[model samples]
Target: MLATAVESTSAKIIAGSDDLLAEILVRSPVSSLIRFKCVSKRWCSLISGHHFSLLHTFRHRRSKPSGLLFRHKPSLHPDATTAPESDFELVQLNGGVSTAPSLRYFSFIPGQSSVSGTIILQSCNGLLLCCSFPFMAGTRRRYYVVNPTTQQYIELDPPLEDGTSAIFLGVNLAFDPSKSPHYKVVCVQITLRSLYNYRIWIYSSKTRSWRISLESFAAPFDMVFTEGVFWNGAIHWINPYGASLCLDVDRECFRKMPEIPFHQSNLAGKSCRFFGESNGHLHLVEVEGPQTTQFQVFEMKVDYSQWFAKYRVDIGGVVAAFPEMIHSYLDSGDGNYYDFSILGVHHEDDEDESLLVLNIPGKIITYNFKNGNSKELVDFAPAGKDKRLMPQLGCFDIYQYSETLAPV
Candidate 1:
């Protein structure tokens, strides 16, 4: 009788230790945690709680991105019959193990009968900013913030003041669970009054409403507002001509970004090859002259004072291995016909492990800066009729994917 009583007490002690159970559960992947909800009512409550989700995100905030979403641009040919059959492909980074959910998982969203109608605009942390457009020409596009891992989503209606005549510029997603569990979506639209002047609309998940910024601002004539990157609490818009813009969401104000350290004459010929944020770092890659194999990766300072040359990459070796990267019909004077696009720059806690993800003629490769080693991560049929890398034609749109349990 005494032994039986002791066994019951031990079982009660083990089962009552929720803190220990939470520690173990936090270490599990989001998928495992979802399945664990079925273990018991207490387990479900703990796993589905907001505080636990925030803790899970904080614990894995520094981990590397799970993979990348590669969206191929549709054919620019006038007579092309249809868009690419696949909306996007997931390129797993961690030993080919994919943790991020597929885009098709969004089928549960209301009115989303087909994945083809929805397009992913931005991926911040784990939430995806997607747009659902109607087949009819005059219908407005619907926006959504979705957590694919949890399959939680919220639809956002267009700003009340957004008129049909307003020219839609772009939208950006900002969510840092380390700072707060809430997320915000910023939408920019160009006003018809002037080409340079634009309006800003912001949506807060906390209030579940949209509001326009009190002030209107003008941007550089050449600024491409469509491609903004969210980093350091601001949405940054880069202009190759040295004029850049950033909107601080916390302060709800607009400011100018530091100029690229290059002479006007030098800047005229260079093009922005890559601009993105990963692991709390913002990097920019620019290529000049006729050699695309050699370029410098620039890192923006946390103070926003300047950009320094963080890494100098010479992928001539990549060119030598894949001769198809060399353009056959076109030459830019110097006979250096290298062709490639910098899809992303992934920074690791160990600098030696940092890598540059590149898209070449017929393959996707990762180039390690420390050792100048290149490895092909994926291969596909060469793009376009010329079988050339035409990034300027919008051939590829890449976004870093990280797994998070943050509720939408």
Candidate 2:
């Protein structure tokens, strides 16, 4: 009877401890989950299991904005007029901070000491797709998919070329941890000889291979391929000159989106526009007038056949609120009214939220539409504290990123 009672008590204790472990695993971040794996054999199995990863991703699906990723080459040369080299450096400014934000350099590249020719392409979920510089020279380029947070990465073979002089138009990373651990990378390549012909290639992590699409579409010469967004099961790219193209990731098909209805008077003979995605809907931001503070935002309907005007924010008010930004713009004397690009929406879960991220020339600023408040997030001054290099203006690229555990 005594032995039976003792066994029963031990079983109860183990069950209770497991219940507590499950609670913590679901709530912790990816960084903590990785470290917790070494705590015990049970934790190593549970935290690294496929099912546990899905559970953790779902629990924080609505996570707040975390940081902004920047890729640029500092001007290391003595002459300011001399162009910066292709050795781009990646940095991040923490956006999730409750106090003052801080800057962090990307220190987790695989074989950091010797790797070169790497270009940061696009980010999806938490993974980044990077390519080597040789691709631009009409040669095959190796691609690297990396997750900086967990310091894990995988390399992909170069896409097959048919000797048509293909140019890598863009790449879009697609990942949803709730669905599966496997991820996909879609690359768009445009032919220089046949200006109208475009090619699509996709790489799957599960298969560890590249699949080329047999479809072809007419593409414009001024296509905006660098800043493509993956949304609604498709990768979309918009050129500021009133043209948009999308590729369905699963079907490997291409289609055109509805033209943006910007009034000629508002455009003032210039096609200054930006594209962004929020809550699974594509957004188009256009300048309303020259030297005017008002800007218009339009959202695409579910059918993707039409667009509806969503919100109009007085951007001039936000800029004026910050005298420094106003002085900086006015001092430039460039007279370009549309000097900023709408990055993305922030604080989406709150009904009273009207915060939008704006990318200025040398810095990023957060503007709240509801209250017309503006604050600077990062300043990319030419001469940074690092004595070896000074960042140049033409090569800066920024993206709003959220924390995720989606593997490469």
Candidate 3:
């Protein structure tokens, strides 16, 4: 009887150990867990499941972001500074606050070139939706959904039929791996002739096809660089008139959200405003003062009807913190000099530590909101050959991206 009890206790201990191991594996980074999936069939099933993916995302979100992904596409213009053979390049900036961060070249799945696209439509769940080069005299555009980490990609066909005259305004990716492996590629395709020509097409991975709808208000007037932001089961883009264009991912329908309030003067510049998401809420970064030194960040209300002023940052503080660093804009001969504008904000895991990435006339500065300190992140002029690049100039597109093992 004692021998039998000993064997039962040992079996219980073994089962407990297995349970603990599974828990630990689920918390591991997607890149590491993906390789472990090959260990056994059971491990593969567990690691690939929606639940595991969700857990992994949540855990990683709590940690500092891994690095930034930079996409460079030189201009094809005759007068552009870049060469015609300037093949598209994707760069990875890998490191956290602890390690020395550096940029490295990344290779896509062989034979595939990402630079063919005009804009990186959207990035969701480690997958990127890029709008391909215009074809048929700008009448059609192809989109490629790619996983940079895995170097795998899938090209999505045009969502319209033959002779359906339409212009693709903007594209966004809706992918929540915790719900399913399948994802959705959404585009705002507008037929210019008609007042009601604004429509949205959603491409479903499960169906392997596209579906278009015109169920909501007219297409948003402004679907520029402030691409759609995915939040609360919907994708959102700022409308120039005030309201926002929202498309429900699950319901596959379009709706209007309240307009974002911006200072009247900010309406002057085409690239004056910026949109982003942080801690599950939609935020807008607006240029406040004439000098552009002051910025007001607003967080959308939970109901999506209003905005609350969240943080107001004075970039001039950076000048005081780093007195030795000379800003080019300070020497402008024009009496009216453009002030530094908020390009982006990188929030840290602790919530208290966040960096306000700003753009001056000729450089980039990262100011720590928590510590009230600042440092030069990059200079557009002489930092390096690849420095000072912007998508509009046909140079490069830079955004904050996390590293993951999300397969194409």
Candidate 4:
């Protein structure tokens, strides 16, 4: 009985040591941490505290992406009668398995039911910026910032305007737990009077309110504000027509990014295949012709000075392995098409460990930049009966997935 009592006392001492307990808890997976909250009030407070969340984020900041959330394109059939079987599918990366939250997770938000039509706009860190459209006309759309891992969310109303007609451009989420536990949502709106003039609205979780920025700026012609990636303490909006635009979130000011180095002739028929921030790096990929099997991966310098080629990617081996990726067109004059999309560029501390995630036809594969080898990550078949009516899997929207215990 004395030995049993001694062992219990030792366990209590270890549990009472906040620093030691936190060191162990920070290394635990988010799913386990969530369940650990029920152990006791002390454990609950420690795990949910902002300081602990920040520490956990810093510890796992270099972790590879857990998975990807793929939002499938809507049906294109003229007489479609029902919604697709599944609107979203989570594809695991690096052979890791994780649970994907469904629309039911959003039920906690007030006045939001039947969230089938809701769509994910962006995934920053571990939070998701989602939009839910009204079922009836004239009802204002709603925006939400959700932490799926924690099953917590907050609804945001549309930013108010000054009585002038404006088109809502896009909203992006910026969350860096290492810097602050709070997150910010950025909204862009353009005045109908001028195509180049744009206004910025920012929502701070700390303030729990939205405020309009005093700095209104004009952008280059055809410069799109959508898909602005937050990296290096700024949100960058890539422009194919001219110089891309960068907004310093901290300073609330606009700046021009270095011009894309590609010559006009090189980019004439090409498109921005992938533009995203991963592991503190911003990568851009462009593909020219339909059958093009070669391209360069460009990485932005840390100082925002310019972009340089990071990787010379040749996907000829992928085509040779997966013949379904080669699309032959008999009726058109255009050459055979290469069916693939660059989903992301994952950089690791070890340069040789870097991988380029790609989607080809019905399979998701990761291509090693160093060895030029390809490995299939996930294989999925088309959902509907008529495959031709469904859009190519590569066309689906892909969002990075990372687990976090940060509160919404």
Candidate 5:
């Protein structure tokens, strides 16, 4: 039996077979091995070894373990001249003992640019997606996608020339192991010109060129990019503007997934944005309307459901605060989360004392809905007390990853 073998091997590892035993032990069920690590120091060292960590990362889905990227709020709105993003830090959210995030690391300096009122994000696969805040003067704004993990960035040219109103970009990062480089971007531009123009643009890393996607959706209002997350080779978005939509990058297609099942119908109040992936499907976190506006997560089980309620967010007894009109759900996955200042991290709290001013109770929070349970991750600083409001989440959603699945 597997148990008999596990017990036998558990007693027989020699000094010279560390690598072999480590590999063998890693092959065992993770929960079982993790339990054995508690049985003795030798097992602890073996399980927590660098090789084991790398193997776990290679086999299972592990966000860069560095920690969650804590985003800060602007004192006067991002557009204000006085409150430039002078410095920002990263806070590793510890889930073992407490949900409270302690400052573990940081990047102390001005964020990528001096421009005020820009969108900021800690993307999955370890990148910070950002853009300059728009001006009333109506100048075309610039955008940047920086991967702090690699210290590399792509500053996109101003979005499709929307000379009249405003244009915002949301990008999804996908990697196709089948391709040479395997990374692709699905950038959707939400612009209000004569109508709600839902334009999807794509950037192929292998081709090293950007092109207009053949796919377009009929959005009711301008579209907004959900958090740029990689799930089953597509990017997802919360379409409070129309029906919820998802874009597939490899196939270059548009399809409407299930909508969040909140009780109310007024699209104006529901703050639904793409959060992260859960159990291999896309998730939309919605700040439900009117009644209490509590936050909830809706999981899409079937990619093409034509609007069905898949699963509900099971919050583990924490207050599900709604997203302030100015902020939305962010997709910052541990190490590879949103990084600013050309990039950012989470370290000491006092390292960036300004963050100390950010209250953990307000602003926005992260929700994890798995195993029929939802747990609150981090509570960012509130944005209303002394401040000007910036364009937090607006007509942008779904960054599709171009990566393909291996042979079934």
Candidate 6:
């Protein structure tokens, strides 16, 4: 009788207000909520509706944007000396047509920032955490967290006087929009090749002080710094050198995860390393490699110990379409492909289950997972085609529900 009444309360709350439902459910027991969703059809639908799904996406799918920093000549004067501007963007993977011709992109330029350049790392939740080295010599470098949509930014004081000489550094950003007001930031450092030289530091909102965590890594491994994706209870990073390891922000300790399967082909001679968050867990995808990516999708399963083949795609000549290109793989495990909100409905299909390979040359080409179809979008590319410029590889992903939300 009590279970039935509690279930009724959940249903009423969900039907009343999504924010109210989330606020109530977030603090409730996860097991009880899972059981409540299975109580009745109306309850199930309410929990699975767009609002509930979006709240779930924010809880589980919050992610950082991925982009590259490169030098480009804004003008076409053979000897033009235009200093390179950091071209940053976020790639949201869509489950609909994979090879959609036109792509969507969000550009990031440091506003009124003293110095900004291409981003090297990101934390989920659409924040590009970056290092902007001084535009001039002998100056300090500033680190920033910028929300591309809102254009709101937070800059950190420069680290040790000679940050250039520091051996290893990692930044962990916590995304708890509930109490954080602003997410918490942590900076980790280890001396160059010095054992037991590990240190953890955090910038708090309440006290506005750098607090060092009590926990530490006994023997830190070599790190390839990217955004530490916040998931489950800890944040994960790609430690490609050996097995994967993560930090428990609450506990502040590093723990190893099951190894991600690697193919000989991927390690042969790829130029860039690739890894992305789909749903939640971490997955390593092929960025650039000798392997002719005959298969486009693979999953890091269970606990990152094995790889599962999900789907396959080919852009054909699409690589030649744009002067700028990027590839970021996103995983679609939600099983909600029918909700075409943005409705990449640019064109209709002429053939049954027939996919369209990008007719032009460019870096990215997506695929329609269902019915094996593809389409091209014109909106998310460089403005006006310049025949001379070749779009080099950058980052790409499918649009998810969280990204479809009003940008901020």
lDDT of each: 0.74, 0.61, 0.57, 0.74, 0.44, 0.43
lDDT of 2 by residue, 1-408 (tens): 999999999767764686566766779877677788899888887776656666677777655435656544432211122222333223333243222112122235443322233556666666677654441233455567876655556777766568433346677787655455677888777755487787777778889887777446677777777777777777888665667788877777776678777754445554336576665556777765345567667888767888887766787765565433333344357654445556666535453565667665566677775677777776654654531123223222554555666556
Between candidates 2 and 3, name the one with more favorable TM-score. 2
Q: Write the per-residue lDDT of candidate 1 for residues 173-270, one digit (tens) a residue.
A: 98877677888988887776787888888889888887787447888777866678889888988777767888888789976668876677887678
Which runs of model 2 end up more than 4 angstroms from their true locations?
Answer: 1-24, 38-46, 49-51, 58-64, 71-107, 113-117, 133-140, 162-167, 178-180, 191-193, 264-268, 288-290, 327-341, 360-363, 379-396
- Which has the better TM-score: candidate 4, or candidate 6? 4
Off by over 4 Å in 1: 1-24, 35-46, 49-51, 72-84, 94-101, 113-116, 162-167, 332-334, 382-396
lDDT computed for candidate 5: 0.44
| Model 6 spans > 4 angstroms off | 1-83, 86-120, 158-168, 176-182, 192-197, 214-222, 240-242, 263-266, 269-272, 300-307, 312-364, 377-391, 395-408
- Which digits, one per residue and each the tens of the lDDT, describe model 4 over residues 289-311? 67689999999999879999999
Query: Measured by TM-score, how close is model 1 to the native structure?
Result: 0.85
Better of 2 and 4 by TM-score: 4
TM-score against truth, every candidate: 0.85, 0.75, 0.71, 0.86, 0.51, 0.54
Greater TM-score among 1 and 6 belongs to 1
Q: Note the clash tally of each candidate.
A: 0, 2, 3, 0, 27, 38
Which digits, one per residue and each the tens of the lDDT, describe model 5 over residues 1-408?
999998787666644577776767755654466577787788788776655644643454432224444334432333444424433334433332222122111121134344444455424443445555554474555556554432335666643344542244555666433232336667767544436666777776556667777544556564446445566677766544545566677788865565456554555665333355532445554544323323433455664554343334333232323233222234343221111110111213232211101122333233332332222334333444522233232212111111111110
